[model samples]
Target: MHMTDVLAAADISKAVAAFAAADSFNHKQFFVMCGLKAKSKDDMKKVFHILDKDQSGFIEQEELCLILKGFTPEGRNLSDKETTALLAAGDKDGDGKIGIDEFVTLVSES
Candidate 1:
């Protein structure tokens, strides 16, 4: 999804308030919350590209699942139910997948 989608989905007031309570916001937190990680900006872009499997710049349900699986360490995978709930909570569009917009919105709420 386009970065503008994030602003559209987010509660700006809430995000600003939450931002105040944090020590800082960083790539690590952004990735972890979105169920991703990378060692550098380039690496992070790689992860984003992988998640955007269709090159549509929007991550569909299947891609979201794949991305989460890629990040989850061996033997530490989330239970089916847990994963389901997470998706349910974050998939704001009710489209069964989470685009970057939805992910940013969800994390901002948290």
Candidate 2:
């Protein structure tokens, strides 16, 4: 990988490690740790796209469960309970998954 890619990967690994030790899942703090504190709706949308691994325009529970792995190959998977809670928080429309708009709002407001 390029130097910048390697550096970013290292940063993400540290962030993921810190997040894994937190008592509760705090989406806003997690995002900030990952250097994903969006300065605009468009920036937030990009982050949502990254998390939406299937490119289905939504973040399913399965995707959320493995969200940390998106940052680094060694990142641990989120527990079932954590995944469900995160889904419920972002799935504002009672949908089983988080759409782009919901994702943006969830991160922006938190």
* Model 2 regions lying over 4 Å from their true place: 1-11, 21-24
Q: Alpha carbon lDDT of residue 49, candidate 1?
A: 55
TM-score of 1: 0.43
Candidate whose lDDT is highest: 2
Model 1, which residues run further than 4 Å from truth?
Answer: 1-50, 53-56, 63-68, 72-75
**TM-score: which candidate is best?**
2
Candidate 2 positional error at 67, Å: 0.9
Superposed by TM-score, candidate 2 places the C-alpha of residue 25 at a distance from the truth, in angstroms, of 3.4
lDDT of 2: 0.74
Residue lDDT tens for model 2, 11-100: 676678887753455666776766656347776677677778889999999899887876677667888888888888889999799999
Per-residue lDDT of 1-110 in model 1, one digit per residue for the tens?
A: 43222322233233233323223333224444443331334444555555576877666655544443333222123345545656787778787777666655554455
**lDDT to native, each model:** 0.46, 0.74
Distance from true position, residue 15, model 1, in Å? 22
Please list the Cα RMSD from the true structure of every candidate, rounded to 1 decimal place.
11.6, 3.5
